[model samples]
Target: MDAVPGRKAPMASGSAPDLMYCQPCAEDGNKILPDAFCPVCKEFLCSTCARVHRNQKITKSHALQDKTSMPSSFCAESEDEKFSVTCQHHSKEFIKYYCPRHDALLCGDCVIENENHRSCMVEKILQVAKRYQEGEEYISLKTGLGQMVRDIENYILYIQVRMKSVDEENLTNINEFRKFRNEINQYLDKRENELLAEIDQTKRTSKTFLNELKTKYTNIKSATEKLQSDLHAHEANSNQLLIVGKRAIKELEDLQTALEKVSMSKDVSRYTFDRDPATERLLASETAIGRLKEGESTTTLGQQQQKQEKKQQEQRKQQESKQQQHKPTQAPSHKVNFQSSVDLSQSQFSRQPDIPMKTSGDTRNCFLSSVACLSGNRILLADYNNQSVKLILRPTWCCPRLLCQVDHGTCVNCPVTGQPSL
Candidate 1:
């Protein structure tokens, strides 16, 4: 039987026609195991062949498991699966190594039973908390950046709307100016036509009056010549002179009337067409029209004013910008300062031995010390053994950096485990 179920026999290709058999057990007539196992030598085999080794009688004393059964669970690698744990320091999956002092995750159970951590100050180790101040600073910076972006966006939108309104107003003013120009042109044309009509009428009336005066003057001259000829023929009679005198008087009266009409019709120097006040007004108006026709004298006073004002405005703007630039932008700057000395000669406890915290790098660690914030944002930490004043920075709570490890022996005024003088 095959080790696993549902196995098939292996086939071999050859030239023989009638009897095509497997190459492993070729026509030997050994008991053919079915498809899965090796068929050669017939020790429960299949069509394909595999090597089979037989041990001699001397080495057969070795104990071996039966091929029909699986491996034992006790000897299996999975037997220790229940003891698997994770390492805290290395952050890896490991077995137990216990910490006796902290009583936390441990790979070795014997570690918790040992006294290696007897001197460790449990109270001081437990005092360390999570950092919240740094988180607050990050949030504040994010809020400030958001507000600045919003303010800039609002200013840009305001400027666009204002510029659009100004453009609309300029268009309206241009339309009004065009309408006013058209009305003035219409008034000028009407006035010019009226003046021309009055001049034409005056010329017609004067010409008619001149023609009538010339005819009357010619008739009087002809009558005077006829009387002279008659007087010469009748010089012996004196009564003819009286009739001639009366006729001359009548002709003189007609001549005086005709002359008065001619004098009234003639244009005086004071009131000639060119010099007339009304015509002068018309000429002045025409000159005004010509000026108007030449196109409007559009003076951009606003532009001129803006150009003039720009200098001072720009100066003022620059001043304001400079002031803004120079103005101190204040942000919260965290400063951590350590005091001069430390004293640690006190604290008698019953159960645990005093463990002085050991620092490897540029940090100073202390155990079982009372640190407090004082006036003027200074910190005072009581170091009992060191017999000196120790200062710690507030806010950042950085480890007490050694500024001056002053010995109380040298400074006579300094007292042990007391506040330092400012």
Candidate 2:
């Protein structure tokens, strides 16, 4: 039954085919199912598109099939299979060739009619792939890939180890700061002792002179009181009193004079403690005792590892060079005949007419430089004197035959593409 309007989206009914979204609608970012398969276009079409495909002159002849029939001859293609590359200019055609000069992938129509490729010598994709399989760039890519994987793995391991190492390094910094604080404490203790001693010396010096004066005055007062007691004792005897009074008066006069002189002496110099301004400034400032210098936050072990690795590399290079210098070449390899499993029983060696190797600009005898072989008994040769490479074709003794010599064009290695010049 057809889906009714205002109902839920269509579902597979009675196994006619499990519902699938329309390919064209999906391309346009819609999700409607109720589709049928078109083998000619190789796309699933919704009912609306199916009706259009049947009536439209361009696609009217295309037959539609059930949406599902997988595990049989016909089936819906996966995304990869449907990943066909079509030209932007020719939307319906697939790309078949690559134009190196234009540096673009093109279809047959693009090669023939596109003015961009008119002067360009286009290459077939298969021919472009000739050296791609075993080329140096491909080998280097594989090597670089493995190296990147190793570097990433080492970095991951480094991170795992660094997590713990970082904490240990932080602890080291903490301990170092505490040690610096201890050093500051020791220094302060030294300064405190010196200051305390300075105060002690000042107080001691001030007290010394005052203590001597007080002792002298105390002795004088004791002597004066004793003399008064003596004078009263002498009064009981008249003659004794008369004789002693004269001497006693004289002693009293002398003691009075000494006391007067004692009060007349100059004041003693006072000693005091004056703290250094630097001490007060030190107390006022937060960082006076300790300055915090921020070190570069880099992993020490990582740097050490880099250095060790560099050293090992240098050592390895030295060892390699030394070994290469001392190593003996294998002379047997030069003596060994070229070995091959190819059977040449049916092959014959025949003499052919010699072709001239001289060029118009040649000033010396034509000397052979190098040779390369191609398929179908063709050989390539380089003539150093003529400064040209020659392609020689011999009779195949089979269906096709060739002329004497064919000089195609000059060839140099394509550094960018790594493609061999034919």
Alpha-carbon runs more than 4 Å astray in model 1: 1-138, 208-212, 225-422
**Number of the top-ranking candidate, with TM-score as the measure:** 2
In model 2, the clashing pairs are none
lDDT of 2: 0.65
- The segments of candidate 2 whose C-alpha lies over 4 angstroms from its true place after superposition are 1-97, 102-118, 123-139, 159-163, 190-209, 221-249, 260-269, 276-422
Strongest candidate by lDDT: 2
For residue 46, what is the lDDT in candidate 1?
Answer: 35
lDDT for 356 (candidate 2): 57
lDDT of 2 at 343: 23
Tens digits of per-residue lDDT for model 1, 272-387:
55557865786778454333233343334345467779888999998987687566544422333223223233423234333233433324444424555465546666655553
